[model samples]
Target: MSDLVAEHRTRSSDWRSRPVTWLVGTGFALAVLSLVGVGLLVVRADRAGQPAFAFLQWNLFLAWIPFVLATCLAAVHHRRGPRPLLWALGGAWLLFLPNAPYILTDFIHLGRRDGAPLWFDAALIGTFAATGLILGLASLLIVHHVVEARSGRVVGWVVAVGSLVLSALGVYLGRFPRFNSWDVITDPNGLIAVVLERLADPLGNPFLLRFGLLMSVLLLGCYLVAWVLGRGILGPLNGRVTR
Candidate 1:
């Protein structure tokens, strides 16, 4: 265990001490990866007749470029935080919960645009929201951990604040009705009487379920994958465990 740990540190040290050229090169590479993810998600969803929101949500949520860059910074910097990791893991679990209803629905061919039991529909919307809220919290933690691990204290704080602001904005948009969204955001299920309708439709509003499955997949699918990758891969890349 000691030797394994030593080897890990060596790699971390090597990367941190590498030339500026390597750092810049790697940053560019990660940027390309980010672009590819966004582009691919968009192209695939569009081809599937999905809404632009799918592409927007996936690309916006994945945030791979910033994630990888922050990981690299964390590796070369402080590299220690208990709360950040806890927030991330816990948030990931919450984000995953929303999918339960979807899973049950699909399992029994009950997840539909038509309608179902009052309780069931409420569960579905609740879960979808839970998933988003959890992921947003997770993103904030991931950013915090990565930035805190890095050297630029001011930059790190900026990143953290920016993440919080973004999450807040997302919640606002999700909850508040928009004047521009009159054509969208209808109510299919209204048990809570508190959940604002969405500004986009999956099967009822503008486009019939021509791609409900695809749209749902785009939102939930990319979100889960990004969450896992950010926490698992990017988190550890910081390469530091303070003693």
Candidate 2:
């Protein structure tokens, strides 16, 4: 009986030591929390006798796309190195990356509803926004690792900063012009035209300039915090797994 117990303990220890175990467990927890946020929206809708913030579900779904892509990209890079497939996944991931942070702009709808109290609505939006931002930051970290592994730390930081800048622009275009990620493919000319029109007269588009700068700064600050905290939290687990 003692031998069996010892063997069981060994098996459990081995399971806990695997990085994949941690990855899957963390993903599962995030998914559960995302569902809980969706549930809150549903409860709000039912109580209000209308579908309030129903779009959050769709937005959250969009936010998950880049996260899923990042997870796949990380797994592929770990197993196969920088293959063409990894680059392809990386490109797709970048396109949808803005969607994750875009949920933050949904706050513009906070007082647009009637039935739900302001506090409840604020909480509902806050839950979704927080989840989306976390998803975005988590995905960014995974891709950052891939870049750092491929090039050097300097190149990694450059790519990360550039990605955040583009993500900020993407969020602006998404909120103001209402262009989806797929527009880059479907409405390339139109998208280019709008961007050029705005760029042609930066002074005339003060709002664009202001929003871009503010959002870029906000994203950069958030990413920096996530990077430092993530390293501190995961460093021990990583050391144990590597050892």
Candidate 3:
């Protein structure tokens, strides 16, 4: 256990010392900037005496929930906690994880609004969605690394693929059924009933299945692309000389 703790710290420290540190810092800065842009849009709407689409701010906040939970799981890994506890933390993280990327679905809400240019509204939603995706991806990699440390790399990859699939289902539920993460705790029986019904007649709910599959593919592709780009950007830290 002590060895595990030491190893976790060593890796974390190494990450902080490497060029990856700068990249992560810049990513976080951009996310913040995106939020700031959203705020500006809200203010602009208010100045124009228009509905601000304030729900977007709330959606962005919901997106942060999973990211924060994943960060907690990462911190727990460094503590070398019991396996059961760690798994529980990971499960909770997974439950809320879909919320992070769910913002992308908000684009469906985009329409012509009085006093707001359509293009500006589009840009605002796009920024929030992008920031939400970044948060999800960063948190996912954090938890993935923790899994990799304890299990094999193959298991880590398996977990990543499985997570993307499950997250897609989660997003569908949130977007259509209007289910929230807290509903799992507050209305477990009802939620379970709905889930069972859907599973029992998967063909009956073709739209749900198709939506989940499509989202899973989209998220998987984004994660892989970003991961490759991150590696490329941090090639120096990986000890490869890049021209």
TM-score of 3: 0.83
Candidate numbers, best TM-score first, in rank order: 2, 3, 1
User: Once model 3 is optimally superposed onto the true structure by TM-score, how far is the C-alpha of residue 179 displaced, in angstroms?
Assistant: 0.6
In terms of TM-score, how similar is model 2 to the real structure? Answer: 0.87
RMSD, every candidate, angstroms: 14.2, 5.4, 6.6
Query: lDDT (0-100) at residue 128 of candidate 1?
Result: 34
What TM-score goes with each of the models? 0.30, 0.87, 0.83
- Top candidate (lDDT): 2
**Candidate 2 lDDT, 1-243, residue by residue in tens:** 999999988966674355355457657877987988989978987888888788999999999999899989878866755468878998999999999999999999999999988999999999999889989998888788767766667777898999999999999999999999999999999999999998888789889889999999999999999888765544422111110
On residues 168-215, what C-alpha lDDT tens digit does candidate 3 reach at each position? 999998999889999998999989999999989989988997898899
What residue pairs clash in candidate 1, if any at all?
Answer: 75-238
lDDT of 1 by residue, 1-243 (tens): 999999999987765454333335544754554455355445545554653223233333333333343344334434444555635543442232222222222222224323344454344434333433433334344455544554344664565444443333233323233211112235423412323333343234443232334444444555456556544544344443333
Instruction: Give model 1's clash tally.
Output: 1
Steric clash pairs (candidate 2)? none
